[model samples]
Target: MKPLLLLDVDGVLNPMGRPTIDYRRYRCTIGTEVYTVHLNPRHGRRLLDLALSTGSELVWATTWEHHANEWIAPRIGLPALPVITMGPGRPRSEHGEMFKTPHVAAYAGRRPFVWFDDQVWAEDEEYLRVSQGLRDFLLVHVDPRHGLTREHLGMAHEWLTLTGFSQGP
Candidate 1:
Protein backbone atom coordinates (compact mmCIF):
# COMPACT_ATOMS: atom_id res chain seq x y z
CA MET A 1 0.00 0.00 0.00
CA LYS A 2 1.24 3.49 -0.84
CA PRO A 3 1.50 5.82 2.10
CA LEU A 4 -1.28 8.34 2.00
CA LEU A 5 -0.66 12.02 1.36
CA LEU A 6 -2.41 13.63 4.31
CA LEU A 7 -2.83 17.16 2.94
CA ASP A 8 -4.06 20.36 4.48
CA VAL A 9 -5.83 22.63 2.02
CA ASP A 10 -5.81 26.11 3.44
CA GLY A 11 -2.17 26.92 3.93
CA VAL A 12 -0.78 24.05 1.95
CA LEU A 13 -2.98 24.18 -1.12
CA ASN A 14 -5.02 27.37 -0.94
CA PRO A 15 -2.43 29.39 0.99
CA MET A 16 -2.68 30.65 4.53
CA GLY A 17 -5.99 31.91 5.80
CA ARG A 18 -5.00 35.54 5.20
CA PRO A 19 -4.87 38.36 2.69
CA THR A 20 -1.93 39.03 0.40
CA ILE A 21 -0.85 40.05 -3.08
CA ASP A 22 -1.00 37.65 -6.08
CA TYR A 23 -4.10 36.11 -4.46
CA ARG A 24 -7.23 37.34 -2.81
CA ARG A 25 -8.21 35.98 0.55
CA TYR A 26 -11.82 35.09 1.26
CA ARG A 27 -13.80 33.69 4.08
CA CYS A 28 -15.31 30.26 3.55
CA THR A 29 -18.41 29.27 5.40
CA ILE A 30 -18.62 25.58 6.11
CA GLY A 31 -21.59 24.35 8.03
CA THR A 32 -22.33 26.89 10.76
CA GLU A 33 -18.84 28.30 10.94
CA VAL A 34 -16.78 30.53 8.71
CA TYR A 35 -13.03 30.49 8.07
CA THR A 36 -10.75 32.89 6.26
CA VAL A 37 -8.78 31.14 3.54
CA HIS A 38 -6.93 31.95 0.36
CA LEU A 39 -7.83 30.38 -2.95
CA ASN A 40 -5.76 30.05 -6.11
CA PRO A 41 -7.46 27.80 -8.62
CA ARG A 42 -4.18 27.34 -10.48
CA HIS A 43 -2.37 26.02 -7.43
CA GLY A 44 -5.25 23.75 -6.58
CA ARG A 45 -5.19 22.35 -10.10
CA ARG A 46 -1.45 21.77 -10.03
CA LEU A 47 -1.63 20.02 -6.69
CA LEU A 48 -4.48 17.79 -7.80
CA ASP A 49 -2.68 17.02 -11.03
CA LEU A 50 0.56 16.21 -9.18
CA ALA A 51 -1.14 13.85 -6.80
CA LEU A 52 -2.97 12.15 -9.63
CA SER A 53 0.10 11.78 -11.79
CA THR A 54 2.17 10.46 -8.90
CA GLY A 55 -0.44 7.89 -7.93
CA SER A 56 -0.55 9.39 -4.51
CA GLU A 57 -3.83 9.25 -2.63
CA LEU A 58 -4.82 12.60 -1.11
CA VAL A 59 -6.83 12.41 2.05
CA TRP A 60 -8.23 15.62 3.39
CA ALA A 61 -6.96 16.61 6.79
CA THR A 62 -8.36 20.08 6.42
CA THR A 63 -11.76 21.44 7.44
CA TRP A 64 -12.27 22.53 3.82
CA GLU A 65 -13.24 19.04 2.69
CA HIS A 66 -16.89 19.95 2.28
CA HIS A 67 -16.37 23.01 0.10
CA ALA A 68 -13.01 21.92 -1.32
CA ASN A 69 -14.57 19.26 -3.45
CA GLU A 70 -17.68 21.23 -4.30
CA TRP A 71 -16.05 24.40 -5.64
CA ILE A 72 -12.27 24.09 -5.52
CA ALA A 73 -11.85 20.60 -6.92
CA PRO A 74 -14.00 21.30 -9.94
CA ARG A 75 -12.07 24.45 -10.71
CA ILE A 76 -8.97 22.26 -10.61
CA GLY A 77 -10.47 19.74 -13.06
CA LEU A 78 -10.95 16.93 -10.55
CA PRO A 79 -14.03 15.23 -9.20
CA ALA A 80 -14.44 14.87 -5.45
CA LEU A 81 -12.02 12.30 -4.14
CA PRO A 82 -12.54 10.23 -1.03
CA VAL A 83 -11.72 12.21 2.07
CA ILE A 84 -10.50 10.83 5.37
CA THR A 85 -13.27 13.02 6.76
CA MET A 86 -12.58 13.99 10.38
CA GLY A 87 -9.79 12.29 12.29
CA PRO A 88 -7.54 10.02 10.27
CA GLY A 89 -7.19 7.30 12.93
CA ARG A 90 -6.77 8.85 16.34
CA PRO A 91 -9.33 9.41 19.07
CA ARG A 92 -10.77 12.91 19.04
CA SER A 93 -8.73 15.47 20.87
CA GLU A 94 -9.90 18.51 22.80
CA HIS A 95 -8.42 20.38 19.86
CA GLY A 96 -11.08 18.67 17.75
CA GLU A 97 -8.57 16.20 16.37
CA MET A 98 -6.67 18.80 14.43
CA PHE A 99 -3.38 17.43 15.75
CA LYS A 100 -4.31 13.98 14.65
CA THR A 101 -1.44 12.07 13.01
CA PRO A 102 -2.23 8.55 14.03
CA HIS A 103 -4.96 8.42 11.47
CA VAL A 104 -2.33 8.84 8.76
CA ALA A 105 -0.95 5.48 9.68
CA ALA A 106 -4.34 3.88 9.39
CA TYR A 107 -5.21 5.78 6.25
CA ALA A 108 -1.96 4.80 4.60
CA GLY A 109 -2.20 1.22 5.73
CA ARG A 110 1.09 1.76 7.56
CA ARG A 111 2.93 2.51 4.37
CA PRO A 112 5.55 5.24 4.23
CA PHE A 113 3.59 8.53 4.30
CA VAL A 114 4.17 12.23 4.01
CA TRP A 115 2.00 14.90 5.65
CA PHE A 116 2.00 18.40 4.14
CA ASP A 117 0.69 21.14 6.36
CA ASP A 118 1.62 24.52 7.79
CA GLN A 119 0.56 23.29 11.21
CA VAL A 120 3.30 20.70 11.69
CA TRP A 121 6.41 22.02 13.34
CA ALA A 122 9.69 21.29 15.11
CA GLU A 123 7.66 19.62 17.83
CA ASP A 124 6.36 17.08 15.32
CA GLU A 125 9.48 17.12 13.17
CA GLU A 126 10.52 13.74 14.45
CA TYR A 127 7.75 11.19 14.65
CA LEU A 128 9.50 9.71 17.68
CA ARG A 129 8.47 12.85 19.51
CA VAL A 130 4.83 12.13 18.73
CA SER A 131 4.51 8.37 18.43
CA GLN A 132 6.65 5.39 17.59
CA GLY A 133 4.60 4.61 14.51
CA LEU A 134 4.74 8.17 13.24
CA ARG A 135 8.53 8.03 13.18
CA ASP A 136 8.33 6.71 9.66
CA PHE A 137 5.95 9.31 8.29
CA LEU A 138 7.46 12.38 6.62
CA LEU A 139 6.00 15.66 7.82
CA VAL A 140 6.63 18.70 5.63
CA HIS A 141 5.73 22.20 6.77
CA VAL A 142 4.91 25.05 4.42
CA ASP A 143 5.62 28.69 5.07
CA PRO A 144 2.63 31.00 5.15
CA ARG A 145 2.19 32.68 1.79
CA HIS A 146 -0.37 34.16 -0.60
CA GLY A 147 -1.27 30.69 -1.81
CA LEU A 148 0.34 27.39 -2.57
CA THR A 149 3.60 28.90 -3.69
CA ARG A 150 6.23 27.22 -5.81
CA GLU A 151 8.56 26.65 -2.86
CA HIS A 152 6.07 24.43 -1.12
CA LEU A 153 5.24 22.60 -4.33
CA GLY A 154 8.92 21.94 -4.82
CA MET A 155 9.30 20.63 -1.30
CA ALA A 156 6.23 18.45 -1.79
CA HIS A 157 7.61 17.12 -5.02
CA GLU A 158 10.99 16.43 -3.48
CA TRP A 159 9.57 14.78 -0.41
CA LEU A 160 7.34 12.65 -2.58
CA THR A 161 10.35 11.36 -4.47
CA LEU A 162 12.39 10.77 -1.32
CA THR A 163 9.58 8.83 0.26
CA GLY A 164 9.12 6.87 -2.93
CA PHE A 165 5.61 8.25 -3.37
CA SER A 166 6.55 8.67 -7.03
CA GLN A 167 9.51 8.39 -9.35
CA GLY A 168 9.96 11.88 -10.78
CA PRO A 169 9.29 15.29 -9.26
Candidate 2:
Protein backbone atom coordinates (compact mmCIF):
# COMPACT_ATOMS: atom_id res chain seq x y z
CA MET A 1 0.00 0.00 0.00
CA LYS A 2 1.20 3.53 -0.72
CA PRO A 3 2.06 5.68 2.26
CA LEU A 4 -0.06 8.75 2.93
CA LEU A 5 0.86 12.42 3.14
CA LEU A 6 -1.75 14.19 5.18
CA LEU A 7 -2.15 17.96 4.85
CA ASP A 8 -3.87 20.59 6.94
CA VAL A 9 -4.91 23.86 5.34
CA ASP A 10 -5.39 26.63 7.86
CA GLY A 11 -2.04 26.31 9.52
CA VAL A 12 -0.18 24.25 7.01
CA LEU A 13 -1.02 25.58 3.59
CA ASN A 14 -2.74 28.84 4.47
CA PRO A 15 -0.72 30.59 7.11
CA MET A 16 -1.94 32.76 9.95
CA GLY A 17 -1.43 36.55 9.94
CA ARG A 18 0.52 38.32 7.17
CA PRO A 19 2.86 36.12 5.21
CA THR A 20 6.17 37.03 3.64
CA ILE A 21 6.91 37.34 -0.06
CA ASP A 22 6.04 34.57 -2.55
CA TYR A 23 2.58 34.13 -0.99
CA ARG A 24 -0.58 35.25 -2.72
CA ARG A 25 -3.55 36.38 -0.66
CA TYR A 26 -7.07 35.19 -1.26
CA ARG A 27 -10.39 35.78 0.42
CA CYS A 28 -12.33 32.60 1.03
CA THR A 29 -15.79 32.25 2.51
CA ILE A 30 -16.38 29.02 4.35
CA GLY A 31 -19.75 29.00 5.99
CA THR A 32 -20.13 32.50 7.46
CA GLU A 33 -16.45 33.08 8.08
CA VAL A 34 -14.64 35.19 5.51
CA TYR A 35 -11.06 34.06 5.80
CA THR A 36 -8.01 35.75 4.33
CA VAL A 37 -5.67 32.97 3.26
CA HIS A 38 -2.08 33.19 2.06
CA LEU A 39 -1.20 30.41 -0.32
CA ASN A 40 1.88 29.67 -2.40
CA PRO A 41 1.11 27.82 -5.60
CA ARG A 42 4.57 26.28 -5.61
CA HIS A 43 3.67 24.31 -2.51
CA GLY A 44 1.22 22.30 -4.55
CA ARG A 45 3.82 21.22 -7.05
CA ARG A 46 6.30 20.38 -4.31
CA LEU A 47 3.83 18.24 -2.41
CA LEU A 48 2.72 16.44 -5.54
CA ASP A 49 6.33 15.78 -6.47
CA LEU A 50 7.04 14.47 -3.00
CA ALA A 51 4.11 12.10 -3.16
CA LEU A 52 5.18 10.89 -6.58
CA SER A 53 8.77 10.37 -5.53
CA THR A 54 7.81 8.59 -2.35
CA GLY A 55 5.06 6.56 -3.91
CA SER A 56 2.64 8.09 -1.45
CA GLU A 57 -0.79 9.62 -1.75
CA LEU A 58 -1.80 13.10 -0.70
CA VAL A 59 -4.88 13.33 1.48
CA TRP A 60 -6.75 16.11 3.15
CA ALA A 61 -6.88 15.70 6.90
CA THR A 62 -8.00 19.15 7.84
CA THR A 63 -11.16 20.56 9.38
CA TRP A 64 -11.93 22.01 5.97
CA GLU A 65 -13.17 18.49 5.06
CA HIS A 66 -14.63 18.30 1.55
CA HIS A 67 -14.33 22.04 1.28
CA ALA A 68 -10.59 21.57 0.91
CA ASN A 69 -11.18 19.82 -2.37
CA GLU A 70 -13.28 22.72 -3.52
CA TRP A 71 -11.25 25.67 -2.26
CA ILE A 72 -7.76 24.39 -1.58
CA ALA A 73 -6.87 21.88 -4.27
CA PRO A 74 -7.37 24.20 -7.23
CA ARG A 75 -5.46 27.06 -5.64
CA ILE A 76 -2.51 24.85 -4.84
CA GLY A 77 -2.54 23.12 -8.22
CA LEU A 78 -3.28 19.77 -6.64
CA PRO A 79 -5.79 17.36 -8.06
CA ALA A 80 -8.79 16.33 -6.04
CA LEU A 81 -7.26 13.75 -3.73
CA PRO A 82 -8.87 11.69 -1.00
CA VAL A 83 -10.13 13.34 2.14
CA ILE A 84 -10.32 11.91 5.65
CA THR A 85 -13.68 12.94 6.93
CA MET A 86 -14.22 13.96 10.52
CA GLY A 87 -17.86 12.95 10.15
CA PRO A 88 -21.01 14.82 11.10
CA GLY A 89 -20.95 17.22 14.06
CA ARG A 90 -17.13 16.88 14.18
CA PRO A 91 -16.80 15.15 17.51
CA ARG A 92 -14.00 16.06 19.88
CA SER A 93 -11.53 13.55 21.18
CA GLU A 94 -12.56 12.04 24.51
CA HIS A 95 -8.91 11.40 25.16
CA GLY A 96 -6.32 14.11 25.70
CA GLU A 97 -5.26 14.00 22.06
CA MET A 98 -6.33 16.55 19.47
CA PHE A 99 -9.84 16.12 18.06
CA LYS A 100 -8.51 15.07 14.65
CA THR A 101 -6.16 12.45 16.06
CA PRO A 102 -8.65 9.64 16.47
CA HIS A 103 -10.23 10.26 13.12
CA VAL A 104 -6.83 10.34 11.41
CA ALA A 105 -5.81 7.10 13.07
CA ALA A 106 -9.02 5.45 11.93
CA TYR A 107 -8.53 6.60 8.35
CA ALA A 108 -4.87 5.67 8.17
CA GLY A 109 -5.40 2.20 9.62
CA ARG A 110 -2.13 0.26 9.25
CA ARG A 111 -0.64 2.41 6.50
CA PRO A 112 2.36 4.59 7.17
CA PHE A 113 1.53 8.30 7.12
CA VAL A 114 3.08 11.74 7.41
CA TRP A 115 0.82 14.41 8.89
CA PHE A 116 1.42 18.14 8.75
CA ASP A 117 -0.53 20.29 11.14
CA ASP A 118 -0.05 23.26 13.43
CA GLN A 119 -2.07 21.80 16.27
CA VAL A 120 -0.30 18.50 16.79
CA TRP A 121 0.48 18.03 20.47
CA ALA A 122 2.33 15.66 22.73
CA GLU A 123 -0.92 14.02 23.68
CA ASP A 124 -1.59 13.28 20.04
CA GLU A 125 1.84 11.76 19.63
CA GLU A 126 1.40 9.57 22.69
CA TYR A 127 -2.05 8.51 21.57
CA LEU A 128 -0.71 7.41 18.21
CA ARG A 129 2.27 5.69 19.81
CA VAL A 130 0.08 3.39 21.87
CA SER A 131 -2.62 2.93 19.30
CA GLN A 132 -2.94 -0.57 17.91
CA GLY A 133 -2.04 -1.39 14.30
CA LEU A 134 -0.02 1.79 13.85
CA ARG A 135 3.52 1.98 12.56
CA ASP A 136 5.87 4.33 10.73
CA PHE A 137 3.92 7.51 11.26
CA LEU A 138 5.48 10.96 11.32
CA LEU A 139 3.83 13.94 12.95
CA VAL A 140 5.20 17.19 11.53
CA HIS A 141 4.33 20.24 13.58
CA VAL A 142 4.10 23.30 11.36
CA ASP A 143 4.31 26.80 12.71
CA PRO A 144 1.01 28.50 12.06
CA ARG A 145 2.72 31.82 11.48
CA HIS A 146 5.09 30.56 8.79
CA GLY A 147 3.00 27.78 7.29
CA LEU A 148 4.91 25.15 5.31
CA THR A 149 8.44 25.83 4.08
CA ARG A 150 11.17 24.19 2.08
CA GLU A 151 12.78 22.95 5.29
CA HIS A 152 9.61 21.12 6.19
CA LEU A 153 9.48 19.46 2.80
CA GLY A 154 13.15 18.58 3.13
CA MET A 155 12.46 16.97 6.45
CA ALA A 156 9.66 14.93 4.93
CA HIS A 157 11.88 13.82 2.09
CA GLU A 158 14.55 12.84 4.56
CA TRP A 159 12.06 10.89 6.61
CA LEU A 160 10.85 9.05 3.55
CA THR A 161 14.39 8.23 2.59
CA LEU A 162 15.46 7.12 6.04
CA THR A 163 12.32 5.09 6.50
CA GLY A 164 12.82 3.36 3.13
CA PHE A 165 9.52 4.68 1.83
CA SER A 166 11.13 6.44 -1.15
CA GLN A 167 10.49 4.86 -4.52
CA GLY A 168 14.17 5.22 -5.35
CA PRO A 169 17.40 6.80 -4.16
Candidate 3:
Protein backbone atom coordinates (compact mmCIF):
# COMPACT_ATOMS: atom_id res chain seq x y z
CA MET A 1 0.00 0.00 0.00
CA LYS A 2 1.13 3.53 -0.66
CA PRO A 3 2.11 5.76 2.24
CA LEU A 4 -0.40 8.20 3.65
CA LEU A 5 -0.18 11.89 2.88
CA LEU A 6 -1.82 13.73 5.76
CA LEU A 7 -3.03 17.21 4.90
CA ASP A 8 -4.06 20.20 6.98
CA VAL A 9 -6.20 22.88 5.37
CA ASP A 10 -5.91 26.15 7.27
CA GLY A 11 -2.21 26.79 7.11
CA VAL A 12 -1.24 24.42 4.37
CA LEU A 13 -3.86 25.30 1.78
CA ASN A 14 -5.60 28.45 2.94
CA PRO A 15 -2.46 30.42 3.95
CA MET A 16 -3.22 32.47 7.05
CA GLY A 17 -0.97 35.45 7.43
CA ARG A 18 -0.94 36.77 3.90
CA PRO A 19 -2.81 39.97 3.27
CA THR A 20 -6.33 39.29 2.07
CA ILE A 21 -5.77 41.44 -0.99
CA ASP A 22 -2.87 39.33 -2.18
CA TYR A 23 -4.74 36.10 -2.71
CA ARG A 24 -7.69 34.91 -4.71
CA ARG A 25 -10.10 34.94 -1.82
CA TYR A 26 -13.44 33.22 -1.80
CA ARG A 27 -16.27 33.27 0.66
CA CYS A 28 -17.76 29.85 1.21
CA THR A 29 -20.77 28.96 3.27
CA ILE A 30 -20.74 25.69 5.15
CA GLY A 31 -23.77 25.07 7.27
CA THR A 32 -24.76 28.44 8.71
CA GLU A 33 -21.23 29.78 8.89
CA VAL A 34 -19.66 31.78 6.10
CA TYR A 35 -15.89 31.43 5.90
CA THR A 36 -13.28 33.14 3.81
CA VAL A 37 -10.33 31.18 2.52
CA HIS A 38 -7.33 32.04 0.42
CA LEU A 39 -6.19 29.58 -2.17
CA ASN A 40 -3.88 29.43 -5.14
CA PRO A 41 -5.04 27.21 -7.98
CA ARG A 42 -1.45 26.26 -8.74
CA HIS A 43 -1.16 24.75 -5.27
CA GLY A 44 -4.02 22.43 -6.05
CA ARG A 45 -2.32 21.07 -9.16
CA ARG A 46 1.02 20.80 -7.42
CA LEU A 47 -0.38 18.82 -4.50
CA LEU A 48 -2.21 16.46 -6.86
CA ASP A 49 0.95 15.96 -8.89
CA LEU A 50 2.93 15.28 -5.76
CA ALA A 51 0.45 12.69 -4.57
CA LEU A 52 0.47 10.97 -7.96
CA SER A 53 4.26 10.93 -8.17
CA THR A 54 4.61 9.49 -4.70
CA GLY A 55 1.76 7.03 -5.03
CA SER A 56 0.41 8.38 -1.79
CA GLU A 57 -3.11 8.29 -0.43
CA LEU A 58 -4.21 11.74 0.64
CA VAL A 59 -6.17 12.05 3.87
CA TRP A 60 -7.46 15.18 5.55
CA ALA A 61 -5.79 15.61 8.92
CA THR A 62 -7.20 19.03 9.62
CA THR A 63 -9.69 20.46 12.09
CA TRP A 64 -11.79 21.37 9.08
CA GLU A 65 -12.66 17.67 9.04
CA HIS A 66 -15.58 16.81 6.76
CA HIS A 67 -16.17 20.44 6.01
CA ALA A 68 -13.00 20.40 3.95
CA ASN A 69 -14.80 18.35 1.34
CA GLU A 70 -17.78 20.63 1.54
CA TRP A 71 -15.97 23.94 1.18
CA ILE A 72 -12.28 23.50 0.40
CA ALA A 73 -11.78 20.53 -1.93
CA PRO A 74 -13.49 21.69 -5.10
CA ARG A 75 -12.04 25.17 -4.80
CA ILE A 76 -8.57 23.69 -4.83
CA GLY A 77 -9.32 20.95 -7.40
CA LEU A 78 -8.88 18.00 -5.03
CA PRO A 79 -11.24 15.07 -4.93
CA ALA A 80 -13.00 14.11 -1.74
CA LEU A 81 -10.60 12.24 0.52
CA PRO A 82 -10.82 10.32 3.74
CA VAL A 83 -10.81 12.46 6.87
CA ILE A 84 -8.90 11.54 9.99
CA THR A 85 -11.36 11.43 12.84
CA MET A 86 -9.86 13.44 15.66
CA GLY A 87 -12.87 12.49 17.76
CA PRO A 88 -14.86 14.88 19.95
CA GLY A 89 -12.83 17.42 21.89
CA ARG A 90 -9.13 17.98 21.20
CA PRO A 91 -6.62 15.16 21.06
CA ARG A 92 -4.84 14.90 24.39
CA SER A 93 -1.07 14.80 24.20
CA GLU A 94 0.88 13.24 27.06
CA HIS A 95 4.24 14.65 26.11
CA GLY A 96 3.36 18.24 25.31
CA GLU A 97 3.38 17.45 21.61
CA MET A 98 0.92 18.94 19.21
CA PHE A 99 -2.55 17.59 19.83
CA LYS A 100 -2.71 16.15 16.36
CA THR A 101 0.62 14.30 16.63
CA PRO A 102 -0.50 11.25 18.54
CA HIS A 103 -3.70 10.92 16.59
CA VAL A 104 -1.85 11.10 13.29
CA ALA A 105 0.76 8.59 14.37
CA ALA A 106 -1.88 6.20 15.60
CA TYR A 107 -3.74 6.47 12.33
CA ALA A 108 -0.60 5.87 10.31
CA GLY A 109 0.35 2.87 12.45
CA ARG A 110 3.24 1.09 10.74
CA ARG A 111 2.74 2.73 7.41
CA PRO A 112 4.99 5.49 6.18
CA PHE A 113 3.36 8.89 6.18
CA VAL A 114 4.01 12.56 5.56
CA TRP A 115 2.14 15.27 7.46
CA PHE A 116 1.75 18.84 6.28
CA ASP A 117 0.79 21.41 8.88
CA ASP A 118 1.94 24.70 10.34
CA GLN A 119 1.52 23.62 13.93
CA VAL A 120 4.19 20.93 13.97
CA TRP A 121 6.60 21.43 16.80
CA ALA A 122 9.94 19.97 17.83
CA GLU A 123 8.15 18.05 20.53
CA ASP A 124 6.05 16.39 17.85
CA GLU A 125 9.21 15.33 16.03
CA GLU A 126 10.68 13.94 19.21
CA TYR A 127 7.48 12.11 19.94
CA LEU A 128 7.53 10.52 16.47
CA ARG A 129 11.22 9.72 16.60
CA VAL A 130 11.75 8.55 20.14
CA SER A 131 8.37 7.39 21.30
CA GLN A 132 7.00 5.97 18.09
CA GLY A 133 10.36 4.86 16.68
CA LEU A 134 9.18 5.79 13.21
CA ARG A 135 11.91 6.48 10.73
CA ASP A 136 9.87 6.56 7.56
CA PHE A 137 7.71 9.54 8.38
CA LEU A 138 8.01 13.21 7.55
CA LEU A 139 6.47 16.11 9.45
CA VAL A 140 6.67 19.08 7.13
CA HIS A 141 5.99 22.45 8.74
CA VAL A 142 4.29 24.76 6.28
CA ASP A 143 4.52 28.48 6.84
CA PRO A 144 1.11 29.88 7.72
CA ARG A 145 1.87 33.09 5.88
CA HIS A 146 2.80 31.46 2.58
CA GLY A 147 1.10 28.08 2.76
CA LEU A 148 2.42 25.19 0.70
CA THR A 149 4.96 26.49 -1.76
CA ARG A 150 7.03 24.76 -4.40
CA GLU A 151 9.91 24.62 -1.93
CA HIS A 152 7.80 22.67 0.54
CA LEU A 153 6.70 20.31 -2.21
CA GLY A 154 10.30 19.93 -3.31
CA MET A 155 11.29 18.98 0.19
CA ALA A 156 8.52 16.46 0.42
CA HIS A 157 9.39 15.02 -2.99
CA GLU A 158 13.03 14.71 -2.04
CA TRP A 159 12.14 12.98 1.20
CA LEU A 160 9.79 10.58 -0.52
CA THR A 161 12.38 9.74 -3.18
CA LEU A 162 15.26 9.35 -0.75
CA THR A 163 13.25 7.17 1.58
CA GLY A 164 12.16 4.84 -1.26
CA PHE A 165 8.53 5.86 -0.82
CA SER A 166 8.18 7.59 -4.18
CA GLN A 167 6.70 6.09 -7.32
CA GLY A 168 7.84 9.05 -9.40
CA PRO A 169 7.89 8.85 -13.16
Which pairs clash inside model 1?
88-103, 89-103
CA error at residue 150 for candidate 3, angstroms: 0.2
lDDT of 3 at 67: 88
Task: Output the better candidate (1/2) by TM-score.
Answer: 2
Clashes of each: 2, 0, 0
| Shift of residue 49 alpha carbon in model 3, Å | 0.6
Off by over 4 Å in 2: none
lDDT agreement with native, every candidate: 0.61, 0.87, 0.85
lDDT of 3 by residue, 15-42 (tens): 8886454358889887898889988767
List TM-score per model, in order: 0.71, 0.93, 0.92
How many clashes in candidate 1? 2
lDDT of 1 by residue, 1-169 (tens): 6546666776676764565554545666667887765566566676666676566666666656566776556654566766655533446543222455444445555566567777776655544334444444667777656445667666766777776667333
Q: Order the candidate numbers by lDDT, best to worst.
A: 2, 3, 1
Please give, for residues 8-101, the per-residue lDDT of candidate 2 as tens digits: 9998999886788888988889889987788999999999989988888899999888989888889989999899998777566665888899
Reference-based TM-score, model 1? 0.71
